[model samples]
Target: MTDRVLYLVVCGAPLAKRVGDGVRAARESGWSPYLIPTDAALPWLETQDLEGAPVLTANRKPGAPKRAPVADAVAVVPTTFNTLNAWANGNAGTYPLTTLCAALGARTPTVAVPFAKHDLAGHPAWLASLAVLRYAGVRVVNPHDGSSTALAPVASGTGEEVAKRFQWSWVLNQLQEAGA
Candidate 1:
């Protein structure tokens, strides 16, 4: 079986924090972690002192050899509406977009956790982009209240709740399905 790595991509500030929290949770859950930030997030990533973790800049070309390290299951946590739309339409003009397109084309499983406000969440464009993503075989998990769930804390009673509900079992299940 192929080894699985968890690729967490961050876009915005709020989502960046959630991604950090998710990374912490994933590490605590005993999974390997690989973090990459889009150009928009590079400054923030550098400020956090992520240590020696591989950091890919957003300015790099999308299909470069360096991006081959991306794993099977990628979680675009707190995906901005713009990024979601771009990926759905095959617009790999940015770093995150290029990485996501490459992974999807490689038949890698992708999970998107959108983080938009209620008003923006219900926008027609957002809904349309979601449909495109689903049609493209991307797993789109939204917040239960029809809002962006990834922006909220995991409903679990533990104070250590992540923005999204990523159970260890669920992750393992997907990995198994991917033959990892």
Candidate 2:
């Protein structure tokens, strides 16, 4: 399983700041993780220690060699509103979005942890988008308690606190259960 690849896709939410913890955990679990961050996530990543994993923030130049192995599974941590909607809509306009879209199309074992405030999650599009991903076989776990059945939206102004309490095991356990 040392060669198993896990694409740890990250977004701009405050939870993005704790990505290093995910990377380290992935390694400890025998997965070779590659960090794929959205442009918005770069700032948070700037301060993280990624356990020396490769960070693929942009698509490679045309004809350039592939930088990472094909993913055995994918985990999207701190899936932001824009990213979740775009991914559910099949809009691969950005690298991270493209990664997500491709992962879904490939039917890869996937777990998504959304970290959005209640106000933003109230948008009708949010529930619809989540349904879309779930129907497509993506395990959409609640960031609060890792529950797959119910997603409790984060309260406004509580993102930092939520990020702190997030457990990477929630995401990892889902992937493991999927036989990743």
Candidate 3:
């Protein structure tokens, strides 16, 4: 896995605050992880903590890391329902969306760990997006299917209570399973 780059795309979901943990987890799984947070997710990130690991966001200053490495694999953890629908519809409105689209276009293996609320999970758009991504060869991990830690409903409060619900390990496992 040396030299392999795993792009971790973080959407603006509640669990996005723990993206640094996900990056570390990805490294443990033998990948050099790059964190690309959607514009909506930027407020959750603490720049100092992500040293060495490249962080790509919507508003890059003159001296910031301007380019993301070419990805061999992509993991979209904290894939909120909105992002899922947007990405599925090929809406590259954000860098995170464009990066995911580029990876899919190149046939690079991609794994998505969605954090949709229990309510929205049943919506037609959500289901159809999942199906579309799957049909396009994206590996989608549903937390509610008894496969990993269950995400709390959207109303779940912040801090320790909700933190316990995100299945961070599942993203690492999926990326590894995709042969990243």
**Most TM-score-accurate candidate:** 2
Model 1: clashing residue pairs? Answer: none
Tens digits of per-residue lDDT for model 3, 1-180: 547788888877766777777777777767888888887778877653664788877646688765756888998867888889999999988788988888888889898877766678778898798878888888877543415334333444443345456666776676667776
lDDT, candidate 1, 137-161, per-residue tens: 6665543332322334233342223
Candidate 1 residue 113 C-alpha distance from true site, Å: 0.4
Q: Candidate 1: lDDT of 27? A: 59
Model 2 error, position 155 (Å): 0.7
Give candidate 1 misplaced runs (Cα > 4 Å). Answer: 28-30, 43-51, 59-70, 143-180
| Top-scoring candidate (lDDT) | 2
In model 3, where do residues sit more than 4 Å from their true spots?
A: 59-66, 144-162, 165-167
Candidate 1 lands at a TM-score of: 0.69
Candidate 2 per-residue lDDT over residues 108-143, each given as its tens digit: 999999988888899999999999999999998998
- Please list all clashing residue pairs in model 3, or write none if there are none: none
Give the TM-score (vs. native) of candidate 3.
Answer: 0.81
- Measured by TM-score, how close is model 2 to the native structure? 0.98
Give model 1 RMSD, 1 decimal.
5.6
1 or 2, greater by TM-score: 2
lDDT (C-alpha) at residue 146 in model 2? 83
Q: Cα RMSD to native, each candidate?
A: 5.6, 0.9, 3.7
Candidate 1 lowest-lDDT run of ten: 153-162
